[model samples]
Target: MPTIPSPRHAARRSLFQSGIGLRLALAALLSALVWLTIAWALAT
Candidate 1:
């Protein structure tokens, strides 16, 4: 027998699928912040 998914799981899957661009932007933003912080530390 096949198991059915719960509502919470379905909602989470949809949210994750919808946030592809948001995830990428967030990743890029975080990467830039880390790079800037490292550069500042090295410059000081």
Candidate 2:
């Protein structure tokens, strides 16, 4: 029989999923866009 993953193991797996380099780059790009929008709003 296959054993199930415990809560901690599941959480760790998800953390690594988001820690991928491509995902990190995408997240950074999205954050930059949001900051730019906020800056433009404040300027106007």
Candidate 3:
């Protein structure tokens, strides 16, 4: 007989992958926002 994986394990793995990607994207966005804000403040 063959063995099968559980649904809970699969869901957890997918969630972990998505969480890492989301964090990276959020960090990039935040840095860009801060840089732009600083440039605008200096220009004014």
Candidate 4:
């Protein structure tokens, strides 16, 4: 017998397989850090 997965399970499975979300989060964090550094330099 074959089982069908729900929408949530499918989404989680895709994320686990490809890790696109993780990469995006890492990129966003790096960008924020760079912007913060620039702002701090300008303020000082």
Model 1 earns a TM-score of: 0.59
Q: Tens digit of lDDT per residue, candidate 4, span 1-44? A: 13456777888899786787888899999999999999999999
Instruction: Give the worst 10-residue stretch by lDDT in candidate 3.
Output: 1-10
Q: Write the per-residue lDDT of candidate 3 for residues 1-44, one digit (tens) a residue.
A: 22356777788899999999999999999999999999999999
Per lDDT, the best of the predicted structures is 3
Residue 44 miss distance in model 1 (angstroms): 0.2
The C-alpha TM-scores of every prediction are 0.59, 0.57, 0.65, 0.62
Better of 1 and 3 by lDDT: 3
User: Candidate 1 residues 1-44, lDDT tens each?
Assistant: 23356777888888998798789999999999999999999999
User: Which 10-residue window of candidate 2 scores lowest in summed lDDT?
Assistant: 1-10
RMSD of 3: 2.5
Q: Candidate 4: lDDT over CA atoms? A: 0.87
The lDDT of model 2 is 0.87
Instruction: Give the winner by lDDT: 3 or 4.
Output: 3
Ranking by TM-score: 3, 4, 1, 2
Instruction: State which candidate has the highest TM-score.
Output: 3
Model 1 misplacement above 4 A: 1-18
* Worst window of 10 by summed lDDT in candidate 1: 1-10
